[model samples]
Target chain A: MKRVGLKDVAAEAGVSVTTVSHILNNVQGKRINAETRRLVLEVAEHLGYQPNDLARGLRLRRSNTVGFVSDEIATTPHAGQIIRGAQEAAAQNGLMLLMLNTGNDRDLEDKEIALLLRHQVDGVLYASMYHRVVEVPQRLASVPTVLLDARSDDPAVPSVVPDEEQGGRTATRELLAHGHRRIGFVNNIDDIPASRGRLAGYRGELAEAGIDFDPSLVVTEDSVAAGGYRGSRTLLGLDDPPTALFCFNDRMAMGAYRAASEAGLAIPADLSVIGFDNQELISENLFPALTTVALPHYEMGARAIFHLQQVIDRAEPLGAAVHEVLHCPLISRDSVARPRT
Target chain B: MKRVGLKDVAAEAGVSVTTVSHILNNVQGKRINAETRRLVLEVAEHLGYQPNDLARGLRLRRSNTVGFVSDEIATTPHAGQIIRGAQEAAAQNGLMLLMLNTGNDRDLEDKEIALLLRHQVDGVLYASMYHRVVEVPQRLASVPTVLLDARSDDPAVPSVVPDEEQGGRTATRELLAHGHRRIGFVNNIDDIPASRGRLAGYRGELAEAGIDFDPSLVVTEDSVAAGGYRGSRTLLGLDDPPTALFCFNDRMAMGAYRAASEAGLAIPADLSVIGFDNQELISENLFPALTTVALPHYEMGARAIFHLQQVIDRAEPLGAAVHEVLHCPLISRDSVARPRT
Candidate 1:
C-alpha cells in the first residue's frame, strides 16, 4: 500500500528517476529516445505511479481546488444533490472542492474566505441552501466567485438559480392538463421569490386556460405541514370549494392530504393534489405518493462550477454577468388526476 | 477589497518588504529593534493581512486539510448533520475538508484516495452514509484514516458508529415502561447490523422484563412504508395480537400508521407505535408526530475527526485502534402511550 513514486518506476525500468520524471512530464526540450519514453511510461503504468498534484499545481500556479463556502447548506436535505453535483463536475475537470460551512455567520464567512484564499484555491463558490438574494463578500472580490442556488442585485456577478416562476408554471400546467380548472392554490405567506414567482405563475397559467383568477380560492399560510393543513382546511370549507389543490411544497401537500381525508375526499376521486419541491423523502413515502415539481438543485450546482470555470479560464473579465436559470421538471406520481364531475 | 500583502504593510510602515516579512513570520535570530517590530505588526494588523497558509503548510509539512471520502453520504437526509459535524470540528482545529464521493464504485474510490494523497492531506476520513461493516481501502494505508458512521472488520482500524443494539433497547424499554407486555416488532428483511442489533436489543429487554421471546410477534419486510403496512397488518390480524408495535425505521412506521387507520385504530389510544431513525420529514410530519430513536450521525462525524486528529498528531503508531460507539436518544413525541388498558 506504499505510494508508487517516480523512483519506484525508474528503479523497476532500470533508469534514473530524473529520466523517468522528464519522460513522464513530457519535457519538450529533452532528447530522450522513443523506446526509453515508452519503457518509462509502461513501467509507471505497471507500478500505478501517481504524480504529486501539489508539486505540479505549485509549478503551474494552479491549485486544482475550488473553495465551496455555503450558508447553512449542509443542514438542509437539498445539500446532498447540490454538493454532489458540484463535486462530480469538479472531479470530471481534475479539481476538488474544499468545503467550509459558515452557518450563516458573516464573521465566520469572512474568516472562511480568508482561509480558502490562503490555500490558493483557484476560485470560490458562494452557495446558499435555498434560492435567495445574497451579497458577495468583500474578501471574495479578489478571487473568481460564482453564486450557487442564489442571485445578487449586482448584475455583473455571475450566479445560477432555479427558475421559480417556470417551476410554478410547470406544476400548474400539470394540474391543468389533468382537467383541473377549479384549483385551490395553497401558498406560503413568505415574501420571498418563491412565493411571488409561484403565485404569478399560477395566475398566468390560469389566465392562459381561460379561467379567471379566483382570489378566494387562494389561501396563504406558513410553508410547513401545519400551514398546509390550515390553508387547505380554509379552502375546503369555502362555500364553493375548488376541486383540486396546488400546494406550495411537498410538506404542505402532506397537510392537504389530511384535509381531504377528513372531508371524505379520496385523492384523484373526490379531489386531486399537486405540490412543489419534490423532496423524495415525503413525496415518495406519502400514502398516495405526492406529485411535485422538482427543484433543479443538482443542475444549479453543476452549472455554477461550469460558469466559474469559464470565468477562471477567460483572460478578460466577463463583459456581463451570466445569470443562468435552470428549469424544473414535473415528477409525476399518484397525486393528480381528472377533477370529479 | 484587495488582498493585503507584506509589501503594502511595509510601504505603509516606512520599512522594506523583507523587514516586514521577517518580523511578521517571526524568523528567529534576525536583528531588529522592538520599535520596528511593533510598528510593522501594527501596520500589518491595520491593513488586515493574512499569512499564506499554503506556504506555511509546505514549511511545516502539514496541509491543514482532511480528505472526506464517502459513498453517497450527501445524497441522504442524514448527510447534512454528519457533514456539518465534521466540517465544524475541522474548522475548530484550523482545518478544512476536501470532499470526494465514490458512489460505492471501487475504481472511483481508489482513484479518489490517490487524488487525496496527491494533495498531501494530513489525513483522510473514510465515511459511509449508513452503519455497516467496511473493509479499509488499501490505498488509504499511506494516510492516517478513520471511519465515520461505519466500522472496520480489522480491529486495528479506528471507527465511530452508533450503538444500534442500545438504540433498540431504548426504543423497546420505552414501550415496555408504557405498560405494554405484548409488543410486536416490525423488522427489516435486510440482514444488516441494524436489523440484527435492534432485534437482539428488543429480545434482551423483553427477557429482562421476564417475558418470553415470542417468534410469532416478529415479522420481517422491506424497510419502507409498504413493508411496514404489510407487517403491521399481519400482526394486527393475529388471534391475540400485541397492543404495541415497534417499526425498524420511520418509513416503515409510516406504513404501520396506514394499517392502523384502515383497521379503525387511533395511534397511542388503540395501538402504541415507536419507530427508529427519527427522519424529521417522516417522524415530525406524521399526525400526532412519531416518537422514535435518533441515530447519532452528527456525533459520529465529529468523533471521527477527533480520533483522526489524534492519529495524525501521535509520534508512534496507535497501540490499539479506538472504536467509539455513540448513543441514540429517544425522541419522545405522541407515538407511544400506556397500552389502552
Candidate 2:
C-alpha cells in the first residue's frame, strides 16, 4: 500500500489541497460547506493521513525555516531595526526566522547552532552587534549561511558589512565643504576593523583635498565619551587648533560636546563636530543635535537575508561566496558650520 | 522485528549512548575509539534506523524545546540579559530555546506562534521589552505559557514582573538618608504602570520618613530628559526650592542634570539627584554617574522560565497561576550626596 498523503485525501474527497490543510490545521479564515468539511475529514481519516509536517520536512529537506544566530545584535539598541529588516525579508521569501543570542560566547554558540541543526533549519544567519571578522562555527558551514555585520576567516562563507571607510570619508568631506582647512579626528583604537577603515577614509579624504595629514590633530582612544573628551581636549590645546572635530562614533561625539562646553566653546559657532553611527538616543536628544553618519545596520540585515534566500534556493552549499559591502549615508544636523575664518 | 532506536544500537554495539550520539551528531571534543565508532555506525546502518528526531518529537508530544515569542524584548537593548536568563534556565532542564522576534505586530506574532505550535514546542515564553500588561494570544493559552516582564488579564497564565514600587522607595530612601527633607520629583505620566508603581513607592518612602507629601514639589511629565528638565526648573523656581530631585527614570534624570548645570549648581554640593532604571548608557556615562534603581529584568526572565518548567513538569495546564513580583535594587553612585544647608 502507498503511504497516505494530503494530496491523496484531497483527490478522494473532491476538495482542494488547501481545503484539506485548512481542515487539518484548524486555520479559520476560510468558510467551507459543513458537508464538504465533514467529507474531507472522513476521507483524510480513511486514508490514514497523518498531517505530519515534521515527516514532510524530514523527507523534503526544506523546513521553510531559517535560523538567525547572533552574538549581541539582538540585545543592543540596534536590535529593533535589524530584526525588523531580517524578519520582514524572511517573511517575503516564505521562511520563518528563528533567532538565538549567543552573547559572544563560542561554547554557547556551538550549543545553539547544534540545536538549530537538530531542528533541521534550512539555512543559518550569523549576525554580530558590531562589524568585524568572526570565525564561523563548523556546524553552520554545512548549511547555506550568511554573516551580517561580520565575516568568517573561511573564504567560502558569504558576508555583508557596512562601508566604514566610506562613512569616515563622508564625515571628513562634510567638514571640508564647510571650509575647515584644519580638522581633528577623535578616533577609536586601530585594532577594530571599524576604526581602521574609518581612519583610512579620513586620511584618504584629507590627502585628496591636498591638505597635509596632520598627525598632531589625530587622537585615538577607546570608543567612549571619556575617550572623546580627552581626545578633544588634546586637539584644542594644540598650537594650531582644528575648527572642526570628527568623532568615530556618536558616544565619542557626546564626550566632545561635554569637553567643548567645559571649555566655554559654543557648538558650530566656535567648534564644529561630526560623528558616526547616528545612535538616536544620543544624537537626537543631544543639546545641539549631532550631525553623524548612519551605520547600514538595517540594510545589512535585509541584504543578508536576501542573500541567504538565494543560497538556500540552490541545491547545495554555494560554490562562490559573495562579499557585499553596503554604503553608509550621512545624516546632516545642526552640528556642522563654516569655520570662523 | 522491533523498531530500531539509539538505545538498541548502543546496546548491540556495546558503546555508551554518548559515543553513539557524538558519532551521529558529529559533535567534536569527545575522543572515542575510531573502530568502535565505525562498529556503532555499521550496526545502526544494518538495523535500518532513521535519525528522525522530528518523528520522535511527534510521538513523545514533547519536543524538549520551548518557544520564546517576544513583541520587542528580543530587539531591545535589554534583549541580552533577559535571553541569557531564560536560555540558561531552559538548558538546566534539558530543553532547547527557539526564539522569534514578533516586532510587536499581532498578525506576525500569530504566524510565528502557529509555526512554533507546528514544531510541537513543549511550552511558550511570551516576553516584552519593558514591563506592562499584555493581551495573551488565544492560541498560547492552550500550551504551558508564562509571561516575562509582562502580565496578562487572564488569571490562568503565569507572569513575572519587576517591583517598581520597591525601586522608587529605594531611590527616595537614599535621598532621605542624606538629610534631604524637601525633595523634588520629576515623574512620568500616571497612565503607565511603571510610573504609577514608582510614584507609589516614592510616596510610601516619604510617609515612612514622616515627610509630608508636597504636591507642589512633584511634577509629572513624559519619561524623557526634557520632562525632567522642565520639572526641575518648575520646582527650583518655587518659593522654597527642593534640595534634591528624584526622577522617574534615567532619561529624566539626565534632564535634571542639565537644569542644575544651567543654574550653576554643582551636583552633590548644590543639588542632589536620584533616578530610576539604571540604564548604563544614560546613567553610567553621565558625568558623576547616576544613582538609580536597577530593574529586575534578568530575575523576571529566569523566574518565568522556572515557572514554565514547573507547569511543563505537571504534564497539564497549571491549576493556579503564579504572579511573581521581584524586587529592584538601588545602585549607589556619586550623584547622591548630603544636602548643602
Candidate 3:
C-alpha cells in the first residue's frame, strides 16, 4: 500500500498541504484557525496519514525524541510514576522517549549517553529513581539535559527534586495538629538530603509549636522495617513515652505498627503515627492505613521534561540553571488522631 | 569540538574505514579478527566516535530500535522488571527501545501506534502490566510484533506469559508438603485468566494429592488486601477451618495475615500461608515476610525482546508463532510451616 501523505490529507480536507503541515507539525507562531487545525488532524487520522518522523527528523535535524536515561529505574517502585509523568508530558509535545537504563554503571552510562547523542535526540532527561545528588554525565554537556528526582553541585544544569524538608514539615504538622506536644521521630541515620532536610523540618515545626526539641525523643536508625522496630521499641520504653510518632518512611511506619501492636497500643487511639513517602503498598495496606507525606515523584518527572523542552526550544543552555522544588502533600488516613492527654 | 566520525577511529586504529564500519555497526558475515575488533572499539571509545544512527538507518532502511508500547506501564509496580528485562536484552543486541505509554485509551493507542510505525521501528513490543488476553491492534499487523505478559486468540502472533496454573500449584503444593491436608484458597473474583488458571491449579493439585476438592474451602473476592482479609476470615470461620491458606497475590496475602493475627493464629505456626506475585514491597515488608510465587515478569520482558528479534532477523514472521509459558518460581520466605496437627 502506498503510504498516505500530507497532500492526501490536504486534498481530503480541502485545505492546502502547507496548512496540513503547519497544523500537524505544530509549528509555533502560526496564525492558522482552530477549526482548520481540527479538520486537518481529523482528516489525517481518518486517512491514516502518518508523518514520516525519520525523514522529517533528517530534514530538520531533530528526531522529535528525548533520551530518558535513568540509573536503576526498574528496581524501584517509584520508577513507574516518574517515567509515566515524563512520558505523558513528552507525548503532549509530540516527543517519544528513547528509554535507557544504566544500572548505576558509570562506564555503561557513558556508552548509553553517547548512543543517545548518536540518535540526535533533541534533549535528555537524566532521571534518578530516587531523589539524591548526582554528578551529571560528562557527555551530556553537549546536549540539553534536565535532571529528574536529582540535582548536581554545578548550578548550570537544571534539576527538579522533591522538597524533603517540606514533606517532613507536612508530616510533623499533621501530628502536631492532633494536639500532641510530645512526639517521637524515627529518623534514618543516613546523612543524605532526605535525612538532613527531614530532621531540620521536624525541628523547625516543633519550634513553631513552642514544643522544646527533645534530643531523647529522636532516634536514628537504618531506614528499613527492622530499624524502625528497634527505634520504636526504644522510644516506647522511655520514661515519658511520646503520645505520637513520626516515621521516616512508610516502611518504617510498617515497623512502628508492629512495635505498637506488640506493645498493646492501638493506632490513633493510643498512639498517633505519621510517615513520609506514602508508598501505597505499605501506607494503604497497614491496618488503620498510615497517614503520611507523599514525595512529588510524578511532578518532578513532568517538570523535568518541561524544563528540558525549555532548554531545547531556546536552542542553547540558559545563562542560569533552573532548579525546581516540588511540594509534598499530606495524605491523611486512619493513623493520626487527637491525643487523649 | 567537531563530531568524531568513522574515519577518525579508523585512522587512530590504523584500519580501513570499511573495517571500522563493519566492526562498529556489527555487520555480520565478515570474519574480522577479535583483537582488531577490540582495537577498533577501544579507539572509537577513546576518540568519542559516535555513529550517525540517522544516516545509517536511512541507508540501511533499519532504525535498530524496537517500539515498546505498554498499556499503563507506569501505574503498576510490575512495570519496572518487565521494562528492565526487555531493555537490558535490547541493549545487549545494540538496539534501543522507543517507549510509548497508552493509558488504555483506544484512540490514543491508535495514534501512538501510528507514530511508532512512522518512526520506521524494526518491530514493536506490545506489553501489558499483568497477564491477560489481548486483541492485537490492527495497525500492528504491518509490523513484527510480540506480546509481553499477554496473549492473543490468533496463534500466529507470538506471545510470552507466566504459567499461572503452575504458580497456583506451586503455592498449594508448598502448603501440602508442609503437612497441611486441608487448605483454603483465597481467589480473586475476576473471571480473568489468572483467577481461572489459579483455581484450576488448586483443584488439580488437590486431585493429585488424592484429596477431594472441597468447594467450601475456596472463596473468591476482590484481589486486594481487604478482600483477602474477608475471604480468609470467612474460611477461618468455617466449622472445619483449613489449617493453611493460599492467597491470589501478595496484597491478598497481606489481608490473610491480618485475619490470622486477629484470630490469634501465629504465622507459620498455627496457620501456614502462601501467596503469589512476589511484590517485594508487600511481601518483603509484611510481618513474618511472605512466601510467594514470583511471576516471571523480568523473564517475560527479556523473552519478548528475544522473540521480536527472532521475527525481525528472520525478515518475516515465523510460519508457526511461538507462545512461550515461562515457569513461576517459588520464593521461600518466612510464611509457610508445618501444620500443628
Candidate 4:
C-alpha cells in the first residue's frame, strides 16, 4: 500500500495543506480552533501519515540533531559528566544528541565523521576520553566542530576544557598555606595537554614560593589506580621524602595515601597530600577528606553545546580557534594540613 | 553538480553496474585482482561517491546501528562504565551506537523510542541510572529492548542487571568470615529492587549461620554520600552498635566511614565496614581499602548488545519483553576484621 502523505490528510480532513502542516508542527498561538486542530490530528493518525524526517531535514536544512563523537566512554569517568551537561543544553535548545563512539580508532573516527555528515547533523562535539591534544580528522574540517576536555595546537577549532593549570596551582597553594615546604609531585607518564598544564601550574606555584623545584622529589607513573600505587612506592622509598605531595588526579592520590599508611605515617600529620579532579569517591572515602580541585565538567559540556549553536546560527566560517577555559575551584577537605616537625 | 551514483561510476569505469556494486562493497576479495580493486577505489574517490545510509538501511532492513537509551548520563557514574562495555561490543560487531538521553522523563522516553524506530535502529539497550522496577512504556513493547541495571515486573522482557542479592550476600559473608558476630546493615530505601535484593541476601546469610536477624541493626536512608553519613550516624547511635557494617553501595559506605571516624572508632579495630558496587573511587579511596562487590557493568553491556543482535537478526516482534540477570563478584580489600571485645 502507498504511504499516506500530507495532501491525503488535508483532503480527508477537508482542510488546506498549510493548515495541516501548521497543526502537525504545533505552531503556537495559531488562529486554528482546538476542534479543527483535533480533527486534523485525528485524520493524520488514522491515515498513519508519519512525517518523513529526511525530507523535513532537507527542507529545513537543519536536522535539529548534534553529534557527540568520543573515543572511549567507560574508562574516562569525567567524560560522562561532560556529556550530561551537553545533553541538557541540547535538549533545552530543541536538539537531539547523536552519539558516536569512535573506540579510539583513528580510521573509525574518520568514518564516523563522514556518517554524521550524511545524516545532516547541524554540528558536532568532539569529546576526548582524556585531556589530550587531538588532530581533527580531515573529514570533520568542513563540519562545525567543538572539542571538549582536550585542546588542539592548531588554532582552527574551538575547545572547551577545564583550567587544569589553575586547579594544580590552587591545590598546591592550599598545601603551601598550610606550611608544607617540602612538597612532592606525583605526575602521570602520558604527555597529554592536561598533564602538561597541571604540571606547569604546580611548578609555577612552587617557584612563586622561592622553593627550588626538586626533580628528585617528582614521581612519574600511569594516571590509573595501579600507576598511583607504584608511584607512591617510589616516592616514599626516597631517603628524604617530602612532607607533602600533590597528585594529578584522585586515583593517584588514593595510591599515595595507601603508601603513606603502609609506612605508618599519618595523613595531615606526617604527610599532607592534595589531589585534582575532586572525585566523588576521594572526597568522601578517605580517612582525612581529600582536599582537591573540582574540574568544571558539567559547565564545559553546556558551554560546548552553546558554542556549537553559535557557530551553526552565524553560518560563519569557524576560521580562528576559540578556546573557553573554565576555572577549577579548590575544596578544602580534611586531606591537607600543616606538616608536623 | 549532480551527485554521482553507482551507475555513473560503472559507465565511467566501462564496467557493468553489478561489477561496480560488488567492487564498491568490497565483495571482490578473492575474485578480483589487486590492480582492479585499487583502480575502482581511486575512481570512486575521484567521483566523490558517497553511500546513501538511508537506502542502505532500508535494503538490509538493518541500520548497522543500535540505540543506547539511558535515563540520565551524568547523574550516575556507573552508566558511563556500562556504555563503555556496550560500545566495545558494538564495535566488535561492526555496528554503531546512537545514544539518547531520556533524563528519566517518561514522555521523553516515549518520544526518543519513536525516533529510534523511525531511524530503523537494529535494537535498543535501555539503561537506568539506578536499579529499580521500571514500567516498560507501551510504545517500546514492539522494539527488541534489553534493560541494564534495571528490571520490570514483566518477566517476558529480558533484562541484564547486577546480581544485587549476590553483592549483598558476599559483603555480609566477608564480614561473617572475618568472625564478626554482631553485624549491622546500612541500606537505601527498600523500594528499589537492588536494595530489596541486598537486604534479602543479608538476611539469608544470617539465617544460614544460625544467627538471629536483628531488625534494629538495619538502617535505611537515601543512597547518596550525605544519606550514607546520616544513616551511619543513626546506626552508630544505637546502644549496642554492631561490630561490622555492610552498606548497600560504596557512596553510602563513605558516609559510614565518616560517621565511624567522628565517633572515635577505628576501622577493623573498632568497626569494620563493607560496601557494594566497588565503584572505582569508593574501593580505592576508602581508608584501609573497602572490601566490596564489583558490579558487572561491562559484561551487562556486552550481553545487552548480544541479546539485541539476536532479536534484530530474527526480525522478531519489537515489543516483546526479554529478561536477563547478570552476576556480581566480590572484591576483598582490607576493611573487614573480627569483632572486638
Candidate 5:
C-alpha cells in the first residue's frame, strides 16, 4: 500500500495541503482554528499519514536522529545491553538511531563520525567496550557528543563511565564481611585507570579492616581466562596463601575457579572468592554462581543519551564538563562465604 | 570547520552546480567532457566535498540505505553477532543501515516499518532471535525484503536460518565418537522447530552408532542453567546413569557441570558432557570448557543482506522462495571424553 501523505490527508479533510501541513507539522498553528486543527489531525490519524521526518526535522532544527558509534560493542554479548538501553531511551524521546559499528579501526571511526556529521545527526554517542581514556577526534566537535563506557583526556568532553574503585571496594568488602583477612588480589596491570582505582579500593578496604597490606598475595595478570588461571596459581602457590581472592573481572575470576579446582579446594567451603564485572553469561552459569560487582553498561548508556539531549538543548551554558561516575553495585550470589578458620 | 557541499565544489571548479552535480554525482559522464569531469573531480577532492547521499541516491535508484528491523535480537547477546555481520556486509556494499529495534512489540514494529517505508529504504531485513515462523508484515511487500534467522508462512519471501537438526547431530556424534554407547539428551520442548530437529538428529546419530533408542534417556526441560541442572539430576538419578550427556545449549551445559560436581563426577573424567551453541562467554569459561555446535548467526546475517541485494537487483525472476539452511559447525573443546568401560 502507498504511504499516506499530506495531500491524502488534505483531500480527506477537504482542506488545502498547506493547511494540513501547517496544522500537523505545528508550523503557524495560531492561524488554524481548533475545529480545523482537530479535523486535520483526525483525518491524518484516520489516513495514517506519516509526516516526512526529514522535512519537518529541517524546519524544527531537530533531526529526530541520533548517531551511535561503537568499537566492537555490537559483537560483545555482555555489552549489547548498552545498545538495548540506548535504543529504548531514544525511542521514548521520539528519536530514531542510526548505528555505525566501527570495530575499533580509528580510520573507519573517523570516516563513520564524518558521515554522521554529514547527516547532521542531532547528537552522537561514542561507546567503547571498556573503561579507558580515548583521544578525542577533532571532527566529533561538530555535534553534541558523549562518551559511553569510555572517557577522554580532553576535560571539556563529557563522559559516563563505571565507578571501578567503588566496585573494587564493594567486592573486597563483601569478602571482608565474610570474615576473611590476608585477602589476595588478582589484578590487571596498573597502566589502566580501572587497575589503579580498583587497587586503591582494595588497599583502602584492607587498611579499614586492620589487615596490613601483603605484597606477597597480589599477582598482576592480563584480563582473560588464562591470565586469571595463572594469577590464581601464583597466589595459591604462595608460602602464605590468602584465605580469599578478589579478581579484577569475571573472566579472570573464571581462571581463579580453575586454579581452585585444580588444587582440590572447593569454593566458599575451603577458599572464598569474589569477582568484579557481573557478566551474566559467566557469573550466572559458573558452578556455585559467582558474586561480582556489576558494570552498569545499560544505565551508563541510558544516562549518556539523556545527557546528550541536555547538551544539545543548552545555549552556551557555562559549567564544568559533566563526568558521571555511576555506581557498580554488588550482586551477591553463591561465590562468597566465611573463611575456614 | 564547515562541511564542504556541492556548491563549494561548483564555485571552485568554475562551473555550474548542475555540471558539478553531473561529474561528482556521476550523473552522466557522456554529457560532460573528460577534462571538465577531471577538473570537477580534482576540485571536489581538494575542497573535501562530501556528496549529499540522499540527493545522489535518487538519481541512482539506490538510497545507499538498508533498513534492519529486529524483534529483541539487538537485546539478546546470542544474536548480536547477526547485527555485527550485517553491518560489516552492508558497509562493504557501500550501504548504510538504519536499524529499528522494536523490543518485540508488534504495534511498535508496525509503526517502525511504516517509518522505514516513508524513508524509502532500498530493502528491508526482518530478523528474529529464535528460529520460528513469523507473519510477514503486509507493509513489507512494497520493499525487497529478506528474513534473517526467521521464516514466514508465505513461501515467496526468502529466509536464512541455522540447521538445528544438523547441530544436534553434530553434538551427539562428537559424544558417540568418544566411545559412548549410552548418551543422554537434555532437550527443549517439541513445539519449537529447533527442539524437534535437534531431537531427530540426536536419534539419527545414536541409530548410526548401532544403539537402540532409549526413551528413558531423554528429558525435556526449559532452556536455562536451572533446566540443565534439573535435567542432569534426573538422568544421573537413574539406576544406571549414562556416562555422557548432551545439553541443548551452553547455559544448559553449565547446569550439567553443576550436577556433575554435586554428584562427585569430574568433567570428561567420569561424566562426559557436550553442549550446543558455543556462547564463548559460557562455553569458554566453563570449568573444562564446553564442546558444542556453533550457530552461524553472523554468516546468516551477512548472507541475508547480500541476498536482499540480489533480490533487489533481479528483474522479476520467477522461482520458488529461497530457504537457505546453514551449517551449525562443531567447536571442539575439553567437554567430551571416552566413557568408563
Candidate 6:
C-alpha cells in the first residue's frame, strides 16, 4: 500500500501542504482556528498519516532525536534509572533516543559523539559510570549536551549530579543526633568527586559539633564490599574504637556489618552504623535495615530530559550551561542507634 | 572548515567518487587494489571525513538504528546491564540505539512502537520491567522484533530470556544435597513466567529425589521484601517447619531472613536458605552472604542486539521465529548450608 504523506492529509482536509506541515510540526504564526486544527488532525488520523521522521528531520535540519552516550551500562547500577527518565521525557516531546555505549573507553566516546553529531541529533546526554570529572570530548562541543551523574570542571557544559556532600552530612548528622560522638568514617580514596564531597561533609558535620576529626578513626580503602570489610576491621582494631560508624556508600557499609558480626559486635548494642545511597538490596538484606541517604536517581533522569527538551525546543538557549544540584533525602531505617557510654 | 565529503576525498586521492564510496563502505567486487584502499583511507582520515548518518540513512532507506522499548527505568534495576550490553553490540556493528520508555503504560507502549516504526528503525527490542508476558501489539508485526527478559506464548516472535527454571532447580538441589529432606519454597504468584518456571524446577528436583511434593510447604506471595517476610513467617509458624527454604528471588529471600531472625532462628543451624537473582546488593548485604543465581543480564542485552542485528543484516531469514535460551550461573556465597539435626 502506498504510504500517506503531507500532500494526502492536506488534500483530504482541503488545506495546503504548507498548512498541514506547520500544523503537524506545531510551528507558530500559522493562523489556524482550533476547529480547522481539529479537522486536519481527524483527517490525518483517518488516513493513518504518520509523520515521516526522515522528511521532517531533513526539512527542520534536526533529527528530533537525542543521543545518550554512557560508559558501560552494567557497571553503573543507578544509570538505568537515569536513562529511563531521559527516554520518557524525550518521547513525550516526540524525540527519539539514540544511545551509544562507550564501554569506558575515551577513544570510543570520541568516535560515538562524532557519530551522534553526524546524525544531527538535536541534543546529547553524556552519562559516566563513575562520579568523576570527565573531560568533555571536543566533538561534543557543537551539540547541546547535558552530563548526568558525572560533572565536568568545564563551566561551559551543564551537569546533573547527586548532592553527595549533603547526603554524607545528613547520614552523619543522623548518627550524631542519635547521641553518638565517637564515630568512625569509612570511605573510598578521595580521588573521585563523590568520595571527596562526602568526606568534606562528614568533616564539616564533625566540626560543627566542635568534635575534632580523628585521623586514626578514618579508614580509606576500596569502595567494594571486600574493601568495606577490611576498612571496618582496621577501624575496629583501633585502641579507642568508635561507638558508631559512617560509611560513604551502602556496599562498604555491608562489609562493615560482616566485620562487626565476625567480632561478635551486636548492632546498636556494641556499635551503630549509617550508610549512604539506600540501595534497595542493602536496605532489605542487612540484619537491621540500613538508614542511608536515598539519591534522587529518578528525578535526576526526569530533570535531565526536561532540560534537554528545553534545549531541543530552543526555549532555553543551547550551551548556556544550566547546572542542577538535586538533594538526597535521609532515609532513617533501623541501622543507626545511640552510643552506649 | 568546510565539511569534507566523498568528492574531497576522491579529489585528494585522485580517484573517482564511486571508487572512494566503495572503499569507504567496504563494498565487495569493486576491484580496488590494497594500495588504492590504503591511500583512500589515509586521505579520508587526513581530511576528517565522517560519513553523515542522515544522508546515508536516507540513501540506504534504513535507519541503521534499533529501538529499545522498556518501562520506567527506576523500577527495573536489571535494565542498566541489558542496555550496556545492547549498546556495546550496536556500536561494534555500526548501529545506534533509539530508547523509548513506556512507563509501563500499555497505550503509551502502542504509541511509542508506532513512532519507532514511523522513524524507520531497522528493528525493535521490547524489554519488560519484569519477567512477564504481555501481548506484542499487532501494529509491531511489520517490524523485525526481539523480546528481552520477557516471553510470549506466541511462537511467531523471537525472544531472549534468562533460564529461570534452571536457576530455581539449582538453588533447590544445592539445599537437597546438603541433606535437607524437609524443604520449603517461598515464591511470588505463579502468574509470572519466572515464578512459575522456578517453582516447576523446585518441584521437579523434589520428585527426582523421591520426595513427595507437599503443597503445604509452598507459600506464594507478592515478590517484595515484605512479602518474603510474611511468607517466611507462615512457613516457620507451621507445627513442623522445614529445615531449609528456597526463595524465588533475592528480595523474597531477604524478607525470609528477617522472619527467621525475629524467630531467633540461627542461620544454617536452625534454618538454611537460598535465593535466586544474585542482585549485587542482596548477596553483599545479607549477613551470611546470599548464595543465589546470577541472572545473565549482560548476556541477554548483548543477545537482543545480536538477534536484531541478524534480522537487519538478513543473514537470518526475516519472520522466522528464533528462540535463544540463555543460562544463569549459580553464585555460591554464605547463605546456604547443611541442615543440622
Tens digits of per-residue lDDT for model 5, B226-281: 88999999999999889999998888998898899889999999999998877887
TM-score of chain A of each: 0.93, 0.86, 0.87, 0.87, 0.94, 0.86
- The count of backbone overlaps in candidate 5 is 0
What does candidate 5's lDDT look like per residue over A162-265, in tens digits? 88888888888999898888799999965788998899899988898898998888889988778899999999988889789899988899899889988998
Q: Kindly list the per-residue Cα lDDT of model 3 for residues A1-341, writing each as its tens digit.
A: 24577889999999998898899988899899989998999999898777778878877878899999999987778898898899889989989999999999999999888888989888999998877899999999888999888899988999999998998888888888889999999999887889988998999999999989999999999988888888999999999999999999988888899899889999989999999888887788888888999988888888999999999989877999999999999998999999986
lDDT score of residue B124 within candidate 6 = 86
**What's the residue-level lDDT of B294 in candidate 1?**
97
- Which candidate has the highest TM-score of all? 1
Docking class of 3: medium
DockQ for candidate 6, please give it: 0.41
Residue pairs clashing, model 2: none
Q: In terms of lDDT, which candidate is strongest? A: 3
- Pick out the ten consecutive residues of candidate 1 chain B with the lowest summed lDDT: B52-61
- Across B58-80, the per-residue lDDT of candidate 6 in tens digits comes to 77777788888876656656777
Q: Extract clashing residue pairs from model 5.
A: none
Q: Candidate 3: TM-score?
A: 0.89
Question: How far off is residue B291 in model 4, in Å?
Answer: 3.4
Model 6 Cα lDDT, one tens digit per residue, A1-341: 24577899999999999888889888988788898899989999998887778766866677889888887766656777777777777777888889887877888788888878788788888887656688788887666778887788897678888888988888888888989888899999758888888888898999999899888888898887788888999999888999898987888888888788778798867889888877766665676777888888777777888877766567444455788989989987888777777
Residue A303 accuracy (lDDT) in model 3: 92
Higher-ranked by TM-score: 1 or 6: 1
User: What TM-score goes with each of the models?
Assistant: 0.94, 0.86, 0.89, 0.77, 0.89, 0.84
